[model samples]
Target: MIQPLDSVIVHTLTRVITPVIQLFALYVLIHGHDSPGGGFQAGTLFAASVILPIIAFGIQGSLSVLERRAIILGGIGILLFAGIGLLPLILGGEFLNYGKLPIPGMEASARRHWGILGIEIGVTITVAATAVSIYYSLRERGEGEEK
Candidate 1:
């Protein structure tokens, strides 16, 4: 159990800055396919946003907000990535050949763009959830316990 800090400055700053960080993370995730930032960077930003509160308010409190949701998100991410990858194979194309994705009215190039975006989204969610899960596991260990 993380002991909640009593400092007003820390709590106030965390509350104020967390949302901004999350918004920036979303921006990074969205523009990643075209720009420099991508799933891994955005996911790290998002994980850090969640962790800011955990650090200021304590793990037990943050757990209620993120624990189950994180697990579910991780599962969703994996399923999405696998489903997208397999869709191409099922359609008689190689795995991850997004040109064969069944998006009605989309040109092959467009479908490829959308498919890459989907993959990036899946990666972002998986990375963020994994980071949060790792943080929780590490923080929840018993005092004096070694792993």
Candidate 2:
């Protein structure tokens, strides 16, 4: 596990800011279709929030929370995206044809909008989970210790 930093201020700030970063990430994800930020950017932000704590407090704490669930989260993301895409096909439309997403009572354009939002959500989850998983895999096994 990586060693925690000794600076109390950094640790304290990390604790305070992580949630804010995560909330911003969600905002970015939600507004992506209408603006510049989207799933990848938001996902990076989310991952950075988790990574900040790891950098400040070490992998020990983050690992306990992320270790087993990261892959599951990734899978959930994939399934959500694929399910939404395939659903259009099952409803007699082309793959990823968001207008056919079968969300009853919505007009085609609204269905399309909601479908795209769901896709963005899936992408956000997948990218964030993948980033954290990669960070864990690439982190130093142990720091400042004899082999």
Candidate 3:
């Protein structure tokens, strides 16, 4: 069992800062196409956002929100990436050849742009879920050893 903190200041600060962290993470993910921030950076930020509650409220509290979804999230992310790549192949183009994508209103450049965005979204999901899974697994192992 985890003990609740007695510090009001810490709790309040954590609550306030966590949302800001998440917002910044989203900004990084969205603006990555035009800037330095991208899937890896944004994903790390997202994982940090999830982890902040663990620092404040312990693993139990964090797990209550993250649950057992980390692996599922990671798998879904990989599938999305692979599926997008394979879509071009299924459309009679080389794998990941976004130029041949069948969007009706988009030029080849726009198709490639959308394809890159899809890949970035996949990478973001995979990285964040993998980071959270590692954290949760390590914490669980540490708790077992402590007992």
Candidate 4:
């Protein structure tokens, strides 16, 4: 059995810091287009936020938060990315040609902006799910061997 920490300071600090980490991850995700960060970086940070509970509480606790939905999340991401690409084709343009998107109120550049944002959201989901899946797989393997 995995032993949790007994220190009050450790528990308290973890509780306080985890939300801040998650909020910062959101900030990174939102501001990525205008700044140095992007989907990959934000996803990693988001995964790190998920990981903090694992470190503090254990895999079972973290699994409650993550569930078994990692693969589903990845699939959704793939669909989002591919669907956006295919949309342009269906609208009589080349793949991922954001200019061909038919939003009535938006110019071509605005359409492109929304398209990029959609792509980034897809990438973020894929990366975060992949990272969490890997972490859970490794932890499960390690636990299995200890028995």
Candidate 5:
């Protein structure tokens, strides 16, 4: 629920820019470990990704597009990270120790790198989506909440 004042500036820009931002965030998330970016950076990018649409289309519409499944996304992310960590424990190694991932024919170093990457990806998605939701909620002033 955008106030008339918010409609003038934020809404217009977000209406056109959110999709592009989301795409960029995915690119960053996928390329994170190899490039200069990682989970934290990519997460912020994703947060910004949703902001435009939220500002433009209003909170409800934005939720229809992305926000509605925020908790589900976060759950999956947690599972991914936890699964990776559990693999090590099952293999008799320390937590987050990917030497236990059981990837056949992969070198130890390579396995470790891959594990870190998977964990980072999960972190990025959960954190970014959460941030976006919070930002939208805070921004949606004058929407007239019910008692």
Candidate 6:
């Protein structure tokens, strides 16, 4: 995405605003277990935090931080889910059976939370990328149709 306007003022504001969004994302991720917010919300917020720069400073600036990392992040999230799901099998329960996570301090609820966090991150990445991809595609298609 490209900024509609280029100005030093917008750049300065963007510098100030991006960090706040990032901190909120972290809050959502950590406090998610007992609250209404969680990884999905946080991940998209994270993506949006990055995307805002794209909208304000253009793609070149957005790439400096967010880059093409969403794809890799999605993969890592999947791996995390798989590892958590396998924990049950390692401890003699069936796949995805959370109670067997094999730690005394952690309960199945924690497992559920951990496993869900991974899934949510994966969901967020795919969703955020897909949203941007669709917008770009449709915009391009619309332009082509005008010819």
Report the Cα RMSD per candidate: 2.7, 2.0, 2.0, 1.7, 3.1, 4.1
Candidate 5 residue-wise lDDT, 33-109, digit = tens = 67787887888888877665655556555665456457577778788889889989988999999977888999989
Model 3 global lDDT (CA atoms, 0 to 1): 0.84
Candidate 1 per-residue lDDT, tens place, 1-147, comes to 346798999999999999999999999988987788988898889999988888888765486557546878988888999999999999999999999999999999999989988998898899999899888767767322644
- What order do candidates take by TM-score, descending? 4, 2, 3, 1, 5, 6
Count of backbone collisions in candidate 3 = 0
Which sequence of candidate numbers ranks them by lDDT, best first? 2, 1, 3, 4, 5, 6
Candidate 2 per-residue C-alpha lDDT over 1-147 given as tens digits, one digit per residue, 9 for 90 to 100: 455898989988998999999999999999998888988999889999988888888766576567546878988999999999999999899999999998899999999999999998999999999888877666644443434
lDDT over C-alpha atoms for residue 97 of model 6: 78
lDDT of 4 at 24: 87
For model 1, give the 10-residue run with minimal summed lDDT. Answer: 138-147
Q: Tell me the spans in candidate 1 whose CA falls farther than 4 Å from its real position.
A: 142-147
Clashing pairs in 4: none
Taking the tens digit of each residue's C-alpha lDDT, what string does model 6 give over 1-147?
223458888888888989998888778877786687876787777767766776676555645323444455556666666777887898899987766776678777876666666556655565555444444444345545746
The alpha-carbon deviation from the true structure for residue 125 of candidate 5, after best TM-score superposition, in angstroms, is 1.7
The segments of candidate 3 whose C-alpha lies over 4 angstroms from its true place after superposition are: 1-5, 65-67
lDDT of 2 at 82: 95
Residue 75 in model 5: lDDT: 79
Clashes of each: 0, 0, 0, 0, 1, 0
Output the TM-score of candidate 3: 0.90
